[model samples]
Target: MIHEDSPHRSATPGWLAVRLPVHALWLSLAVLAWFAIAAFAPRFGLLDWRAGLGFMVMTAGPLLLGLAVLVAALALALSLRSRPRGPWWKAALALAIPVIIGASLLQLRATAARVPPIHDVATDVVDPPQFSASTMALRDAAGANPLSPYNVPLGQLPAWQGRVEGAQAIQTHADLIGQHYGRLQPIPTGGRDPAQVYDAIVAAMADIGLRDIRRDPDAGIVEGVARTLAFGFRDDVVVRVRDGRIDLRSASRVGVSDLGYNAARLERLSRAIERRLATP
Candidate 1:
């Protein structure tokens, strides 16, 4: 005769006892450590953005996340039959970190898919604002994406967002940019000449957080570099205020895809310029 409080029987059934094993927390902690190294390495200058973010985070993060998730799931399954709860809630909490990171990575991948693979973004695509000699020297010395619209060497290219080789990559990038970002055009100067708006343009550039801003009033060019907050990735920006219009170009110093970052930055700068021009 079995009793209701029999020692052989579990007070909590398998369904209610379904909890992750405490040991699984170690897997989650490992993933958290990997995430920290991957994310902060570039910002701290411990590693280059290409190596830290592109290779470590984007390339290796998913594998670790998958392993963590699998271990947590398996641990939970095995612990379901165990009588002791065994700090299972802490294990469940730990599991959330990898899942969240995996979701964020997926979102980033989706954003990359939506945008063109080109790192260079220009308001004037027909005749994109050329970088100054010094700026070109800076970029070239650092092995940046070529200022030329296309004809990038295959070997020099970073891991592109899209699977393309040689000229096809650039062509596809151009076509996609034209399709999705045709609205990125020169900002009107409201009947003001380049001379009138030159100072305001410089002010706008500074207002929008551009650093090392160099202005050539005679040439009507205001150039600066924008460093990203997370990875410290540098994108060169050259603003051409000419012919009663302001055209801007933002090009990443590395990588095959800016993940729509340059375009978004240009949009913010464009708005800043417009606001400055509107102000008395």
Candidate 2:
């Protein structure tokens, strides 16, 4: 026969009037603890923990603290039922409240300490082939000799381009290509046409059934997908054919588990290129 009025009247005054400043204190302490951990032992501490600490601090900490506060309020209400008797519930609640709040605050602080900030870049650069004249010429030349690799300068190859010798020469040549063929330093001192190079690469890729071909003639770069065996993968092939020498670089993503697959695919692609070139 508990009456609603009785329940409302039973709520203790001190319990009903929780000091908001106390909660603020807990929050402040939690924030400080997090920062302290981040400043010291940052690597091994919870502050460095990505998933667990972040989730608890960002979502679980507040929820658990709120629940503990509700429980304290309930205890206070029960204590008021024995008014004038000096409710023991009030003492019990007071003791439990601080302990629960402190624990939650500590955990939240640790989580906050571990959480890291994220950064992103913002720019307004237009899409690839920003210039098209070089690309057009590349496409035209590629139509005549798709496998020549002689249409552009060898020093202007893509960064991802490399030879499979597992040697350092590949990287050295790649840098040279960038310096000589990049839009920043066109061959023959301003004579390098990005649009022509882009067009040539696009035409070559098309000849090999590559899709999603994109060219940045302004930057003298091209990227696309090439199909090999039964699967399709992205390719970052840079071409520069200058000084009577042709430099071609083809790169595809590889994973530890797919080493065999990648090797086989590359072999097949090489054979296809050889056959295409021999045809003419």
Candidate 3:
């Protein structure tokens, strides 16, 4: 039963180890750890969500990739050894799950790196419509990131500044932002008068699930906060009806990089208003 020179004895156990996920357990555990920290960590409120997500993106993300590589190597060897068996292909595919998920997370970071690291995006960058005082008050309140719509000089925020390139104090001027995201171009009234457009703006905000909706008739400013569905991150939105143009601004209440969410919000609202305004 024991011959030191026997190839079958040595090869069979090694093949079983690789083909059965003995080394691949590292990949599974790392993937599970990332999922727990990135997703459920916010729900538990164990730490600031930015910290939690950042750790997942910046730290665990790389670790996951490393683990995936190891799994891939071991799994590849096992698949070669097991190919003659009936279902060896399944083991190889199973080992690839972690690699695919880890690659996706890294891809997100790569895409974000190519763009400027700024959260505030407005349709009208130059003289972007300011948030109403009431909306500012809500944003400054607890559970929201305290930010000045105009005076939030970049580089001043320690957490946010750390995410930007070169780590210098960034200038928040509209021109700087316009260099990247030019004015979204005011949604034309499309023959609708100021009153109709203003109402449509408010309706669009509500339709998009904004909370605590308020409007100032004289100022023609509609103010509300849009909360993300899953984690409830709030973003302040201000729509101004002036000069026959509907100018909009959407800024996240927390986190330095919004991942283009604020821009997407403004775009979504503009499209919704266009449809509603066209409806008689």
Candidate 4:
């Protein structure tokens, strides 16, 4: 029997319409927690790095998006039903979480798309600076495959993304770094002495929390490895102090594209060096 003034005749789904704002509240918190797991679990050893990334991209991302839309639509519908507005602000806050996370991820992807899938960058191509014995030993212990951008068999260059992509993509990726970043100029030492410049390079590397620093003062070559905080992924680094120029090379220990991290790292190091020298 339908009443003329039926308050119960509203279209809000009981399942969708939960305790004023609690549904949105829980959903937002869940989305935020999922984001945290995706970001920090790999770093803290709480989750497998590969699995964490996969879950974030494949599962959590889509789930947040779909759930956010569903809840937002339901909330809007309920509010428009001429019934009392239950804590709508909670729904807004809940929706904001997934929206924020999704927007950030999209920006990251857009930046990545603009970058080439090359992991190595150097001042010169003819003879890129070589790493020291310490780095080689560490890589060996870590089971890091051949560390050069050359045509090696699959599983050899684990740091590169193409290794997983297939064997044929190996040389194709190697050619990318050489073709793109070749002729990338070395930083000039402002005519400073090589000894002084080497110290500065060491200081700069230290500022960036580099590992396994190897110094060859006589040869004017300094080598070290940088690691990403989240996954401890390694990037080999070498600095050469010439008469008036300082050459630099940075190559990811794995992955075909470093997401433009290597180039950005070099810029940060360059700025750090300038700051160090600027200090009286």
Candidate 5:
């Protein structure tokens, strides 16, 4: 009597069988790779026109190739169904292609997600508090006398308290400019209004064909090219003129270097003030 043998079952492994339907892995990986490129490309110079284009090609090419290989492997596995005796490793290898691709893509995306964006407001057009030619002239002339109304000695003022005074004389001056000139009020005590002063200084410096002026308003210091090789910081120049003498005050967070720059700028500002003060 002839015996009939049982039909052969497909010998694919359980792990591969479970992983076969995970097409999302490849897609995820691809997304990750794109993000990685985006995040780090700038730092590595890969985002440069020529380099970025090349990087894009390289990244996409390998992913597409892997996908193609995956598709081919899957197709081959399916085609081998008829033979039933084909190698088991072939099926596992075919499935792994897409999984590897997905993992790579995910890695790239993770890298991209780690980068932070850059922010800059320096060159933006900011409306600064304005000062009237007459008022500024008066203040400058008063500041010049060393015994005038605006001059105050640092010794008589309170010690540096580190907080920006909102109602100090310097702040009051800034407030006056805003009220009279329609510009935003800057912090009075700190070097809050350096940008405003910067514009004026730049224009003044430009008149003499000097271009490399640097101003640090936070420190109340302004330096670089002007009529002369001028360098001044805050804290060195602000003097309250009183009783025919110069009174230096530690009203704000102005430092010694800052004062030096302020002194220089104040001298120029004083000249402008004098011109206006002499008028009528």
Candidate 6:
């Protein structure tokens, strides 16, 4: 029988002392590998963006990270008292993995909370420029988020606002646009020919990294799809030149909240168009 004060005695049980550090090391590596797959698999079309982001990255990632943290903490604590010092470096590395990932996830959550939960943005919220039939067809086929009506003419706002208890009066998408992004108004053509403005818009779309551009000069509309750099998620953008003003509308093909991507895209495209028009 081994005595409590025997020279060979260790604070951690023999089986546990060996297993915990090993588990910590492998768990940390698994977290790193899973993160890469979650981020890049969608971009390469290996998986759907929704599945990759919603399930793998946001859900499973956190779960794995939580496990890693728990396991690593146990390992580190036991290692401090183990006669032959446990692999302290392995526990430290495992702990570091979750810390980094948790920080990034927190930052992303903060950004999402700051923005209104809307995906469509337009320069003219009232009767915003409409997408073409073909463009609408593509969006429909892909199960894109439907464009909210210009205003709540369907009488949704009043119905939502009428309740006395537990009622949160919320504005329609159009009203949200006006409240949050009132500065995004139409760009004046300055008496420039509509055709000239159309050409400028096309160049601006290209400059802003849109793909598969389709311009209908006769219809006075230009439309393109913007593929995000990270996940290749598509956002449809259309520009209309009418009534001596240029208007833009950007709607994401998926996602309830764009994290303000559509609004930011419109801002970038508008600035690009304005720059081109001012040059000539």
Predicted model with the maximum TM-score: 1
At residue 259, candidate 6 shows an lDDT of 89
Question: In model 1, which regions exceed 4 Å deviation?
Answer: 1-7, 10-22, 75-84, 150-162, 165-174, 193-196
Q: Candidate 3, after superposition: displacement of residue 26 in Å?
A: 9.2
lDDT string, candidate 6, 12-58, tens digits: 77667667888997988898888877778888899888787889888
lDDT of all the models against the reference? 0.77, 0.38, 0.68, 0.69, 0.35, 0.82
User: Model 2 shows how many backbone clashes?
Assistant: 25
1-280 in candidate 1: lDDT tens per residue?
A: 9885565566445443454455568778878887787777787888777777867787887788888888777666555545654456655666787899889888988998777767888877667787899999999898877764434432345555346656545464445556768878899888885666887788888998999999987777999999888777789999997777889999999877688999999999999988888888
Query: Per the 3 Å backbone cut-off, how many clashing residue pairs does candidate 3 have?
Result: 0
Give me the candidate number with maximum lDDT.
6
lDDT of 3 by residue, 200-267 (tens): 87889888888878888698788888877534577888888777778888888876667777877888
Worst 10 residues of 1 by lDDT: 148-157
TM-score of each: 0.83, 0.24, 0.76, 0.77, 0.23, 0.81
Measured with C-alpha atoms, the lDDT of residue 206 in candidate 6 is 99
**TM accuracy, model 4:** 0.77
Question: Model 3 segments beyond 4 Å from truth?
Answer: 1-10, 14-19, 22-33, 40-47, 83-90, 143-172, 190-195, 207-209, 229-231
Model 4: pairs clashing at backbone N, Cα or C within 3 Å: 159-253, 159-254, 159-255, 160-254, 160-255, 160-256, 161-255, 161-256
- Candidate 2's displacement at residue 149, Å, is 23
Residue-level lDDT tens digits of model 4 in 154-203: 34555544334543344543455555554356787787766678788889
As a whole number from 0 to 100, the lDDT of residue 96 in candidate 5 is 59
lDDT tens digits, residues 1-280, model 2?
Answer: 7775564454455543344324434544454454344334323443433333345444564565565555555444444454433344443544365466557668645643432110100011111112134434554553311221222222333322342223322333223323322322212212334444444445656666667677554443454544333122233344343432223344333211222232233344334433444442
Better candidate by lDDT, 3 or 6: 6
